[model samples]
Target: MSDAEAARALAEGHLVILPTETVYGLAADAGNAVAVAAIFEAKGRPRFNPLIAHVADAVQAEAIAVFDARARALAEAFWPGPLTIVAPVRDRDRVCDLARAGLDSVAVRVPGHARARAVIAAFGGPVVAPSANRSGRPSPTTFADAVEETGAFAAAALDGGDCAVGVESTVVSVLDGRVSLLRPGSVTREEIEAVVGPLDRDGEGHRSPGRMALHYAPDAPVRIDVVEPRPDEILLGFGPGVGALRWSLSPSGDLREAAANLFRRLREADREQPAGIAVSPIPAQGLGEAINDRLRRAAGFVG
Candidate 1:
């Protein structure tokens, strides 16, 4: 569908599937309590887990969430990209309490996808969009996977091709004059620290999305940092040494390329109905941190 159609659906308090740089999102009007509730119902998402309110720009983001100096600097450096800032809610009416999960703070971001921005601009309001998949499932990074996952619940679906950043946005909390890394994504901790100095490793009291111990998982079991795959297992290789049947995230060990292909490969491996999925070791640096985060969650090894 077109952006105008998607915006119209959102304005009428209906769910819409929108494509973003990170992944396809199931979007709904944030201010509409009933509409926001539908998202939880459709995705089987827990109400306590808050949704991320996607805006067109930093100006719109500031109107909904209180942006401190750190938040502003991060926004100036990373707006229109895969970075979400959780801050105190400035406009409660614009983002309903349900969307914020009854918290006083809201997680908001300006998506880098132009079509997504266009839809938000046409809708003329903030929209709560979470990964377009069932709760705890791997987020859909392609239009086909998104439609298959939750298209029945949406009033319209906009296809913006494949997502560039396969993982979700890097989420950070800029509360109490301190910046804490809530969730890592394509934007690394190093990048955020460069703009806002050191980040507190502890993210207590900062409710961010996608924090479940077991999330972004596939049907088959996942084993991370595996050097070899079992006979019945499907191996997702990283750099080199990939066998004929194995899938390589990046033959050259490019973290960015691996991030872009992470979910898609997981989905493919799951389709094979393997006994388990074995993943090659990925370095814990830059985009690899985010990739490893998702992998750990997929393997149900995260705390």
Candidate 2:
């Protein structure tokens, strides 16, 4: 279906597979109860796990939540980008609570993709979206992945090509004047620290969506390969190997590129339905941490 039509469907409480700078999101009108519920149903996602609300601008974001001066500053610095900041839902709780699973806090961001902005502007409300796929599967970077999960619910999917950034947004929650890294994503801890200063570093054990030790996982068992590909395993972040399927993170070793391609590659391997998948080891630091986080999740760690 057309993007405008998809936007219309979403505004009318239907699901649409929409593009984001990071990945395709299973999007719904965040202001519509039935629409938001459909997103949960589409992914078989637990109610307690919240979705990130997307907007076109700061004004739109502020209308849905209470964003103090700090938030405003960050919005000015990062909006039209891949950065999700947790804020009080306030008036938007009426519509967003269903997306947030009754949490007082709402995850919100203004994606950098032009298509995403276009869709949000067309709908004229918060669009609470999560990665478009079954809850435990690797998030989709293309329309093909969305169709695999729910073709009926995704009446329309905007073809914005593949997502530019394959990883999720960096999520930070400012608490008692301290910034906490709720999720390590496209934006790194170092980058965030540069902007927000030394973080409180919640360091896991936090009740947050992406924080679950196990998240962004596929149903197939995952094993990380530090040396070479194993015969029976589908190798990810490498190239095709004789006995094993090869997938490489980034031949150039670009963390951001690897992050962008991470899920797409994992999902490709999953389509093969190998008994298990083995990931090649990425650097333990930098975006490698972000990449490893997703691998660990696929290996069965909860956020």
Which candidate should be chosen as best, given TM-score against the real structure? Answer: 1
Write one digit per residue (lDDT tens) for candidate 2, span 1-303. Answer: 665787788867778888888878888888787888888788888887777888888888888777876777777778888888887776664346677777777778999999889888888878887888878778888777777776567778777888888888878775456567777777777877777678786532232466555678876788874456567777665433323334666666677777878888787777788888877767767777777878888888653
Off by over 4 Å in 1: none
lDDT of 1: 0.92
Q: Please provide, for model 1 over 136-238, each residue's C-alpha lDDT reduced to its tens digit, 9 standing for 90 to 100.
A: 9999999999999999999999999999989999999998878999999998999999999999977853398988888899999999998878999998998
TM-score of 2: 0.91
TM-score of each: 0.98, 0.91
TM-score, model 1 to reference: 0.98
RMSD of each: 1.1, 2.6
Residue 210 CA displacement from its true place in model 2, Å: 2.7
The 10-residue segment of model 1 with minimum total lDDT is 238-247
